[model samples]
Target: MNHDTDAMFRTLKPAGLDTTVAEAHARRREQDLAAAWDATGSGRGVSAPAARRRMPRVLVAGLAAGAVAASAAFVIAATDGSGNSPGARPTASGTVRALDARAILLASADSAAKAPLTTGAYWYTRERETHFVAPMKLTEAQQKEVDRKLGTRLKGKTKADKSSPVTAWVSHTQESWSGRDRHARTIVGIDPKIKFASPADEAKWRTLSESQRARLQLDVPAEPHVNNYDFSHAKLLKTDEEKQVSALAKLPSDPAGLEKTLRKWYQDERALEMSLDGRTSENSFAAYVFGEAQDLLAGPLTPGAKAALYRVLAEQPGIRYLGTATDSMGRKGAVLALGTNGDDTGPIGKNFEIRLIVDPRSGRLLAQESGDRKAPSLTMTYEAMGWVNSLGARP
Candidate 1:
């Protein structure tokens, strides 16, 4: 219905890939799109939760961590978009109801517009996630070398534990804080270990008749010594943070203007980033849109900016309305789907998707989840956001 919106969506999709493998790599890259926002401390003004110095590793490692399977789809549409029939509305805690995705998003836009404008000395986000990990093969010497380089010893305690690679379903609580001109800081805490001993154990596990790992209650080891940590050493220059913050603060509040401005912002960011490497790719559009959405949700935003962001999302192609659902934190909200619209027509075609969970009453973002449904899912929740006067302060 809206040509401008349609153009924006078209602009976001990368041109067709040369090979199925290329397509797979692109989809895999899309999963990490959100993490880039968390790691970028320059150009566009959003700061990763850690200093700029750690940019490369944070982007690469964080995004690669949770490659998992998606849960069953939670939202189902109840009505076809038609003027003759009003969509069904369900009462809270009652049966599922069908509603148009556009309507839900527009309603959210109105709600977002009414939210109070907020900012803080620091931009803060907190998240808790559960994901699976397959062990890496490292000899004793190699493990020691890794610890030497990282300044931390990470050996398994028992001889058997050290010899075997571990398969784990790890749960961790993480927090990030970004302030003007200072490095972003991140703190991470892990739950007690739920390890599968080693890859050998997992290999042997395959011989079992049932592959449902959930059926077996695994043992929880005490928190590993190297797991609980905090870091602020990454360097984020004030000038860079200020430049990005200034740019973000200046974004237009209307959808058309917002789209235009964001496109330019993303372009400039990519150019700045790629100028160092002397290579550039045009297929980054869709991924940039996804990353920008995550960035705005985590960064300082006025109510107007928030409203515009929601409207932008509502306009994107393949953004489906999945009705009410709860986040990993057990917060109930409506969910919207993006990137997951693709099917397995090509290699790794259906491997990427992002789900945004938002509070219907206030249009506040509750959480963002992306990655494969069958692998380790990466979920980041907006546990806290707002203007605070101090870096370590919580809003």
Candidate 2:
């Protein structure tokens, strides 16, 4: 396998979780792995569309713990392109010239606390996702194996045929609307305009067979279909969405109370994990809370609760400021990262970073990125989020 593909599998497994819970998280990881494989034109000939099906929310619950653990190998990069350290404090002019990760989180908490609340019939959100697929570098034998699987015979006679690897950028957009009645609708639009590294690579791609191209996941339908879900039966609805919405209504506003409540929830979740697999996790409590907060930040949160979550993040260790950067949607925001690169005797022995870009003015989460610092393997940008009166509306 190529380095990119190998790196993906190495980083996919979550540390400190047993096979049972890890398998649940694997559903999502499989999609990502398949995408990378398809982009590289290696591995089993599974179409990206087939592997890109969205997993159920039941499987999505408690994913933050694993995600945070997967990023434990992240090495800190330079802070803000400035020679300053991550502990730098903002100047007294009220302008954030250079601020530490803790200070940034604190400022975001203050902004979140004062944010205005809104209400509507449905909660609407629009997000863009980009997955970078590195070029596949295969040996002659590996290329032959790929050809045999696809029933193709394109010999490397020309220089173009012998090109080292072809790089691809895969991107898509997803929109969702969830009502107070527990009904939800989701739409996923795959971007047809995939960017290639060079015209030579594009030319090489056209020479492949139709089936071979399909395995590349480039033939996705431009018009996305809508998926609907009904969860009106409160007693029967035991999904994570139900739990999240229910919890949002009752979360304590104060930071102390919120932290206390979250800890109780964490203990309950850990207990459930122990009951199911009989394995206890060695992950830090702060890391677990940080992961949970990361997931909750995307949902409809009360201003006070959101503020408390930010404050909770401020207390966690290993967080560093990455300065300002533009998200996939071309919006500028302050980037904060949490991770460390060191010898970890965990299930997954690979290292990667997780970054969260926040709008300092509104304390809104703009985007999230994960993977190596040079090129993120996965990036999710929040284009729009708020309450809407109708299912087809945007906020």
Compared with the true structure, what per-residue lDDT tens digits does model 1 show for residues 1-395? 59999999878866663467665643433322222212211110100122223322222222233321232222222122222232344324343334555656666677788887766656666655443444334345545433443344545455333221334454555666666444455665534333343576667555533323323222332442222222235554432443354456666888888888777766776676566445443334545565456567656677887788877776766566554545555555556665533331211234445566666567777766554433323445566666666656777
lDDT by residue for model 2 over 1-395, one digit each (tens)?
69999899768967645777755543433332222222212111101111111211111111211323322221222233333343332333323333556666776787788889877778777777654443334446545544443345777455333332345445677788877777888887645456665687678667766665554443345588789888787454223533445456557778899888777776776686576546545446665665465456776778888998888888877777765655554555567765322222222213344567776567888777554444444556777888888878988
- RMSD to true structure for each model, in Å: 14.6, 17.2
Give lDDT for model 2. 0.55
TM-scores for every candidate against the unseen true structure: 0.57, 0.63
Question: In model 1, which regions exceed 4 Å deviation?
Answer: 1-98, 135-166, 190-247, 269-287, 340-349
Best by TM-score: 2
Model 1 steric clash total: 21
**Model 1 TM-score on a 0 to 1 scale:** 0.57
The collision pairs in model 2 are none
Candidate maximizing lDDT: 2
